[model samples]
Target chain A: MNHALDTRHAALLLAPLTLLMLLFFLMPALSIVWTSVHGGQLDLAAYRELLTSALFRRVLATTFEISIEATALTLVIGYAIAMHLARLTPSARAVMMIFVMLPFWTSILVKSFAFTIVLGDAGLVNRAISWLFGTETPIPMLFNRVGVVLGMLNFLLPFMVLPVLGNLLAQDRTLQRAAETMGAGPVRIFLRITLPLSLPGVLSGVLMCLSLSVGSYITPALLGGRTDMMMANLVDFYTRQTLDWPAASAIAMVLLLITALIVVLLTRVRGGNVEVL
Target chain B: MHNSLPDRMTRFWRATGGLIAWSGYLFLLMPTLILVPVSLGGSQQLSFPPEQLSLALYEQFFTDPSWWGAALQSAKIATLSTMLTMLIAVPAAYALVRGDFPGRRFLNLFTLSPILVPVVVLGLGFYLNFNLFGIGGSDLSLVIAHTILIAPFVVVSVSAGLRQIDPALETVATIMGAGRATIFFRVVLPQIRDSLVVGALLAFLISFDEVVASYFVSGPSTMTLPVKMYSALRWEISPVIAAVSAMLTILSLVFSVALIHLQKKSRGH
Candidate 1:
């Protein structure tokens, strides 16, 4: 009857969610590891093949390459925008944040589809090009590495901006004033003080973007050429196309490990705050 | 006032920075905004400015069984999944917030681990596990998968809500001879109603937008709207798909505006 229950009552209260997670969430996730190892009685053949196969290795490399590219692109653009947003008055910021957050709230499918239209042959960019320069042929943008990165940036920018913006907003205003009083120019103060203070945010944003971009299946599959397949697509390839559960599970495990490694490294590098999530 | 070279250089840099940042904002917004006009295309081919504006795509979306049917199926699944996620998440949120127990930190991490795991991996895992149970493509399987996908968000939102309320409220209820159920329903629930609604909205939106996991677990009959759009995109480019995208974007916009309003209201309380 008391509000604060003993451990027994606490456990009872937690039982339903605990059971739900254990049965559906934990069991399904654990099955990936099981299938990865026990391909009919304790086999590591999938992992061995993954190590030996050029195609899998190439895909893994591409995943990291694309993720890094996307993360770098997102950070540059996101930092610029976050810098601008941080300087805005609160009322103006609220309005601007709607724009930043709207795309994030929308489905990734819708965003991808929009990118196809905006970057496709008869899309907006091509139309603008024709109108501007009288070009007859539209430049290809939608099915290459360019398109993949562009599509990814649309979804990833908000993740980067929000975090960096948080850190920027949290900075002491008097620090900048102090630096200015010391005859530091705006650029010098920003470079010496603001940039260093905001590195944790930039690091976390990089982490978020990289992890999301690495495990992304939709953007590359929709926008990239066949040569641009990432690890997630490889997982999908084995699962849907080839029906090789072990191979799929192996790639998934690798992805899981990469993501875990990123989290661990970033958190540690950021002085063990663990707030990257 | 001094017209100094350094001041002029600073102004120039500020202008350049604003231009770069505004361009980034434009890039962020362009894709979403482009869908609205394209969705109004009069022709069958997808294009910008649409050549001629019409509601034919919207008409198609409504009259066609595939589009509207998938919409209905998504709504149903999201509703059910939201309910299931809330049911499991609310009490666990209460336990995490109020009921002190060992391994609470572990429990918190476990609850949120699903969000950290890759969806593609979760999809395959769900496919394998559900196939083992012989319910791989059923609506039930999709619902369960979705609940797992969204339960973490519900837990986080509800737990935040629970944290906001004073513990003394519960003590007062207990002192007045109210049981746990009465204290929760009467004392705690009323205070956190706004956040409960927020959690439900978030769960519904997340479940509604989910595609990767549903793509694996759902059969042809059980395909949700996003999954249908995904397949449709892979196979062809139709104006109606544009309409679908526009509608979904609007849905997201509406939900987000509502969420922002609710969050402000909750925080005010």
Candidate 2:
């Protein structure tokens, strides 16, 4: 305690963690990129293989399509909940926060399993439907894009609510009060003032949702039909099925770049409204 | 004043907003708890509102060796990783909070960089790293991989704890002739012990629940609980998995509640 807080003291304190990161994290991550570049030699064959394959191209497209759909839906639903949360008193907010967090606490696999039953032909939804419509035939809902998207919808909703709620709380309330006093309509106030101010949360939440959906494997594999594959499945398939590290590394790099690109674009769009995420 | 147009409008929107918001929350929350009912189903098939309430599936989960092994393996990995993460993150977070040095900001970012990368990529990185050493299926491999992922949370929790402490306590101890190590052991650790306990628990829960990375690294012999459940889900619809899932969900819910409660109390102080 008597020692000065200097570079030497800091370095000493940081050594164990720094060494851990170097050995396990940085080396492994760099090695993947390094492997992708040096497939038997310093060449671009892996990238070329990925680029030339029509199947890989389609998988990329499908990944984005599903991710975008899930991200948009999550933002809308989560914004509604977060807005509600921001308006509540502390005790009420705490109760409502638990509801948002319940799915988050549960495993993603459990949610997928629940949907497998909920959306299956003989599952709960169809059972209810048959009861209402006077029919015994089970509706085929699982093993499709709808089920896949719904599974992801369950997983990402909390991620959306949390960041948006944080930004909404951190937001200045007097600005809205000022707008109210100035006779701005509620719709106008929301559109021009409140919504604009919550952009950082909205932007970050969307980015998180999109990235997660794109990389998701379990939902698509367990809930979706054969055709609904996301990028994570591609990575898993390459690494496990084909044992193609080079190809896997290439596709992974591509996926990471796409996520990075989207993140950069959104942060750019947020412009000068930098705030804590 | 009597209700104006704007007043009436606000009232209407408020009512509708509450309905939509509550429905969205229920929609997000209720699906996962489906396992609770299905887990109790007396029938062989997974179903809600069980044909009859029974502990048959729970019995199966309890008696099964594969299930037991996976659970044990998961617990072992989670414990080892959490301990290792604490060992590293305590000092790292301490340095970041209390020390003054060059590249401090960069070190902070480095600790948190894992959160930016997708789990699949990290899983792949770990898979490759371990494969080179022929430790791909070893417990050490799983522990190390999970340690890397869980360490960031430890740093965050400890740093939060660090912020909650009064620096004057450490400064006073320093002036009273306590050495740096003595101050850390006797003064600083006592103040942040809540964070250390809760942080370790959170890290344990995180490692226990992790699937994607565990899936990549775990082989047949070294499979963890989540990975085992994933395999069961993929291979067939086993009712036992429903029991396992229900149990996992409850455990996670309790752990999260405890962690959040601790965090709230810490901040309340």
Candidate 3:
């Protein structure tokens, strides 16, 4: 009776989630991969087309360039903030941490719109510049790479800060004190001890920011100019505007492949143990 | 290259670090602050200092039927999507945490891969599949799409909570002659209740703020607030958009504060 009851409980606990995954998560993902390859027949033509297209090559390069810039900026800024939080009194740390997280909890779309207003031609920055400089023309800040990078960094910074903060909280401060007592200077201790110890968190943050920034669709679309269109935007245009599923799926597959490769390379270089979440 | 030189260099580095940290804080805060005053502007175009300050735009958002209707529809979809995500995530998280089963690792990855997949691809897949079923532009489609998108976050959070619990507590309760269902309800549920709430709240927020998926799946009448804002921003920047954005920003801040409070309380406990 106990065995039978155990089996029944297991079945009851597992059935719903399993069914949902099979229907929604697994099926849709599989269908996307399958459709990309065999929407009509077994063909490498879509893959071939993407590889040979100069437009795609440029888009891919731009995606990587933007993601790298965003990742680098997030790390430098996030590290300083995390260090400050670590050194703060507990109550002050908590309050400041909440402030750091404020933008993250807000919708990315809302924040992007805020950037648009602040950076637009007739917007605040330009208006302020015109008043100060007595200039007739508003600065061309929006619809450029500067606008897109600023918008992307606004979203990516929190992701970088949180992971590094988690690692800092988990760190032992006594080691730093011991190093100081052993005649090591503050810079020497930080470089030799603290920085190396925080590598796990730093790598985790880098991978997370890089992947998200690369896959991001909305920020670039809204803040970017026509020439700044990334791979995700191209996928959207092909699928929505051009009505080309095969081509869209092909682009997605390539995106997935590149992302997967980068993740693999990151893990390998970082010693293969980082939780991305 | 001497002892006093080291002290001076350390002090200089500390000041530089402090300066960078404060600048970073400013970078994060300034963009968010720009929206608040703009929402209060009286002009049709967006401006920094208002020639006139009026509540007319906020009033328009409240009094206008189309705006209110879109807000209501978005709220309804978000609510339904949150419910669906919680329903799916809780049991899945439970099994992954407690059940020692085959393919569990694969299942975990399968659930999370949605986040890694580009949104455009997911949107395309839904557009095609929903169109084939004749449900492409329905409210139900949006709800289902968002549920899939957010369930993984729910799973991760709840699983983290599960890992934190001592399994021996549950084992002891079982050995005390409590039935499995009784143990699960009386012992397990109460322990993880806070985490479950946090997870569900996060799911709700994700669904509430969703835009790209809604843009493709929603009909004209079923458009969410973000979709409306997106369409408007493409043509013009008005204080009305600012009004809507300010409302959302405030709501999100409230939720974020609550989430932080809950997290601190849970950690304390």
Candidate 4:
């Protein structure tokens, strides 16, 4: 029968993806799990040691702080853009989407390089400020938390806007139109009608922004100074710097745990669609 | 008659909202666009608004042998990985979209799971895995690692495209005595060709832009472009960085426009 042949074709098709993922992805990931528990023999000592370290605590705290701050700022900026996009005609939306997606598609290194050009001591921002205000001092923009957040916010804002716009567009607009016809004040109409309706998008945007910023390494590494460190930086430090594979694996597990727990908890709370890309 | 209190208030609100929205868009574009003028900068220093307009940075980047070597290595890796990823992902996407296979959800999750892990961890995994294989310093390892990183994008893109197609056409092809492979090649593949092209381009971009994994796996002689850029940013501010930034931005914009145009054309059909 055709059904028999179709099943075989399906299995044949799936074989390569299965094999490559198992060999390349699953095996390497399992090896990390194994490494975390085994130095000479099976144990949880690596994770224990990692948890007990002051550096671990500081790095985790910093990662969360930066991610939360970045997500908040991105939500504000992204919500505005998505709101604007939600009202546009299809052709105009396409053009605006290109600009938003440009930074998303560009190399992270190139985007960070742009920050180096703009936010450096002698960079464009500093140069402009000096000219405008006649200040002799160049602001300490790069190599700090401000620089790190600014760079990361550039990347995360687009992610927030896209999904929010999708949700907003899919939403029912009759209620808003009815409210407008009923003479609800503009600010009151938005606060009472649109904002409440878009909460799912906002929630999804926050989760996406938070998860991405939490794991981000490149932006912070380029923009932040020595004292500013995140969880992924610690993972890199152990893997590359110290060659402590077990310790690195342990920290990675912890990082994954934090991110997964937050995502699971949020989905449970809101029961919203969480389509993060 | 339409200029009531609410209408007037909403118009003002819309004006401010548009202002805020455009500013946000500008903020997003500012970093990438700032490099354009700097790329034309003549002075050796990485300064804004060049002392004179010249293409020295571009000239410097083009003339450097190491830069060429890195670019070549990146091209080789990206092309190889893109080919391999499509070879693997296209079939998988086909199965996921069309098959009555069991454990389909699990298979879908399995393909996308790589993205859930932090890239730093993924890089370390590749580094250690390669070392264990005793192929730690080779370009083969880089290519393989990049394939794993990029294959998921191909799968997802192809899956989306396949989902857009109607199932009735495929069934008709099969009922007309076409074999599965023939149907795929003649009927299905043609429909999803745009997806295949866009997915391959995404795979290439992901491989080309990947730095963390390349940083770990790359030996002294095999650094990729982004890895080289990272190292340059670490030691000194090379004026050539602006040129590279400008070039990469152009490449990305062109690729993105191509992707969008292809998708729009496909959707029009």
Candidate 5:
């Protein structure tokens, strides 16, 4: 259908949002680039520091390392849950979806705090372990990589599960039935028909999880140690503790670039896969 | 269906898969749910399965000025931002969905651009922008930043609502001599009220829960609950936060269920 409003009225309606985005969103974003280049004097000193600084390099490495690990773990666990959800009846799936979506409703800070409560030295897990095994030493979980990954897995699992489940549910059941009628075993049918069809969903889920993991701040800040800091934590450290705006903006620029690159690549890969799913 | 080797293996796989899947669900629900009992504990120290079950922490949250003060401030800011976001996003959603204009695609993409940017970057950008304007660390700055952060969701939600409505209604209104503004206020708004409410609730929740940008923009004078919780959590795990967390969990649970209901209503329409 054709648009209801003509250009003049449409422009009038759209003006507020356009102006808001430009003034608040676009200009502030540009200010980051300007600040990164020595307050618009066109110097690359901040970028140079980002490239050469050992601390920055290690933080970058840690960011990628933790994100990749978290993404892998989320995909594995998320896929299992999604697969199970797909097999259930629709009414059952609707009930199970609430459990899947519970984390999304809770604030990240609360969830992170909950993790600390559960995983701390005197927390429930250690208490359970010590009680059962008759041991005094608690397994160190909090303020480490384990805590960060666990928190991230909780936050990111829904992102992975929803997309994969969408694809799994969208798959043709007749193909599986036809394969079964041809004497193909359940395992073979799953491997050939279901798994291959679900690849797009898995890919989309992976990209979403990986992107979220890479830029995540709250989890790492609350649950991680100094060495376990992600790029976002580094951004916070530079912005707040060190009072280094240039260094912070430079780091921000790098993060923005990486995220944009991933999104661009994902869209390219996802273009053809849309119809398949 | 009988116990052939493949059928038995399939059953075993289903059983184990269900176990693992349920374990994953437990992991998702456990952390947040565990906070309730922790909040009920009567001690300074944080422990699960509370040593003494009491309403001590809950009482403290209500009585404490700093915690309650921050909560009120967050509510104020979230409300303002939600209003501001809807003020802009509703019209934009209408235009994007029903109005023909130049740069329509560009406008759609521009609205969503904020979500693509890492929030930390947006936080820093706002920090710098507000500092440049000499308005850094103000409630107004935080409100503006939050509106920017959450506008896209409102726009998307309202746009979906707009799409589902019949265009013929507007066309009929126009044919019967109603103006665009009249139709929008009289005809369109009522039709999309459920979505608008859902979107507003979502905007409220997001702005209230926002931490990264608020951290940079809010000052000691205007510290939000999440920002306060964040700083406190960074240093030490405060027992009071468990009460705060429990309350927040309940609040979000209520809003989320309401949102689900409103969504179903919107879709059902």
Candidate 6:
């Protein structure tokens, strides 16, 4: 009876959360899949059309290209910054990390807006560029790939930095010292010892940056030109502007599927022995 | 020869590394610095190192009723969503961490999947669903959407805190004849209090900053600061928007500092 009561209490405690998960989270996602398939009857036409569309292909290619570049840039920069932080004293490390994370806490809208102020024509960068060059015309920086990439990197830098920092902090420093004592150069030691050991962090950061960059809507929409648009911007354009729910749902399902596949591929590459579950 | 070559390479890499590090810092800080002068511009246009410096934009933000009302609405929604997230996530996190349960893995995935899905996708789905229910353009819908969005952060934070605690401590308290309720209230809750506070703060910030979902679900009465700024941006590039953004930046910085301070204090404990 006591065991039964314990089970009952657990069930009661979990019921509300379970209900929310079912109704709000799982249901919405499944509904997207459902809506995509059954616009009128069971049909693969939406998927077929989306897959074949040249615009869709272009958007997909743009998404992958931008995400890959962003991921690579973030990993290299983030890894170096994490290494620098790791070498600092604890208090300094804390202060520096706080700086690194400041943008993460700020609104994405605010960050993107701030970028516009810096990157826009007559904005800071253009003003400075014109002043330096003694030119009358402000450089066109906004409404371009430069603005979108800058905005994305501003928001995403911390995501890259934090995971790498976590792994770096957890690493044993004595091994690097040992490698140095054995006449291993700093570059060699870093590449052979630190970098190899930090693969998990690098992998995680890359995955995060890729996933985030691919799905980001606000940054690209506000900053990017039509040619600079990502898949997420397309999804928003379809759903919000055109009121094309079925097409939007189809695109979303494809995005979700592609993201899942990437995660799977990443997990396998990282180590198939580790249980993703 | 190879030894000297390696040494030279190391020196080159170190210099390159330092340059990259400085660039990274500038990249992070430069955009934020640009907001200040733009906010203070006397002219209506957003120009850096404004031809004239004035506080009119700040005044506009403060004096305008709609701006203040939207700010208040954002605060209200953030508070309500934070509370809801904490209530739901704490118990769920505790169960997942401490209890043996079937489908716990699935439950964990369910909590995290929201983070994986594009915000626009979620926004569209919610818009469709909420419109059908007649709550599409309501504050209630915004709160619900935000709670779902932020609950995962609460769960992650609380779960991290739970992992640091020793389950044996709770077991010993129970063996010493403490009631289950007493053990939970006295032992478990106190141990995880820092994480709970951090989680709640994070949830508040996340909900406060959320724009995509807010844009879709919120009515004019329910417009958040970000949503308001976004709409304003579509129409014009104004110094007023800059002032509003600067205020938000300062607010976010203060909250982040407070969170970091709390984390440091807990670490010291």
- Give the better candidate number (3 or 5) by DockQ: 5
Candidate 5: tens digits of C-alpha lDDT, residues B1-269 = 44377677678877887888988999998865788888998756778888888898888888999999999999999999999999999999898888766788778877877877788999988988987777788888988999999898888889888989899988988888998889999999999999899889989998999999899899899999999999889876678898999999888778877887678778876
Model 3: which docking level applies? medium
The iRMS of model 4 comes to 2.2
Q: What level of docking quality does candidate 6 show? A: acceptable
Those runs of model 4 whose alpha carbons end farther than 4 Å from true positions after fitting are: A1-5, A131-134, A262-277, B1-4
The residue-by-residue lDDT of candidate 3 on B1-269, one tens digit each, is 55687688778877787787887887787656766787888547666656567788899888887787888888999999989888867777777778766666767676776776667767777876777667778888898889888888888888878777877888788778998878777887789888888888888888888888788788897898878877777666555877888888888778888888887876776
Better of 5 and 6 by lDDT: 5
Candidate rank order under DockQ: 1, 5, 4, 2, 3, 6
Of the two candidates 2 and 6, the one with more favorable lDDT, higher being better, is 2
DockQ of each: 0.64, 0.59, 0.50, 0.62, 0.63, 0.47
**How well does candidate 6 reproduce the true complex, by DockQ?**
0.47
lDDT scores of the candidates, listed in order = 0.87, 0.83, 0.79, 0.84, 0.87, 0.79
2 versus 6: better DockQ goes to: 2
TM-score of chain B of each: 0.95, 0.95, 0.93, 0.94, 0.96, 0.93
Candidate 1's error at B176, in angstroms? 2.0
Local accuracy of candidate 1 as per-residue lDDT tens digits, B126-193? 98899888888999999999999898888888888998888888898788889888987888889999
What candidate 6 gets wrong by more than 4 Å, as runs, is: A1-6, A130-139, A265-277, B1-11, B176-178
Q: iRMSD per model?
A: 2.2, 2.7, 3.3, 2.2, 2.7, 3.6
Kindly indicate the candidate among 3 and 4 with the higher lDDT.
Answer: 4
* lDDT tens per residue, model 4, B152-213: 88888898899898778878887898987898889989988988898898889989989988
Best by DockQ: 1
Structural similarity to truth (TM-score) of each candidate: 0.96, 0.93, 0.92, 0.95, 0.96, 0.92
Model 3: how far is B34 from its true place, Å? Answer: 2.5
lDDT of 2 by residue, A36-99 (tens): 8874477899999988898799899989888988888888788889999999998889877777
Query: In angstroms, how far off is A169's CA in candidate 2?
Result: 2.2
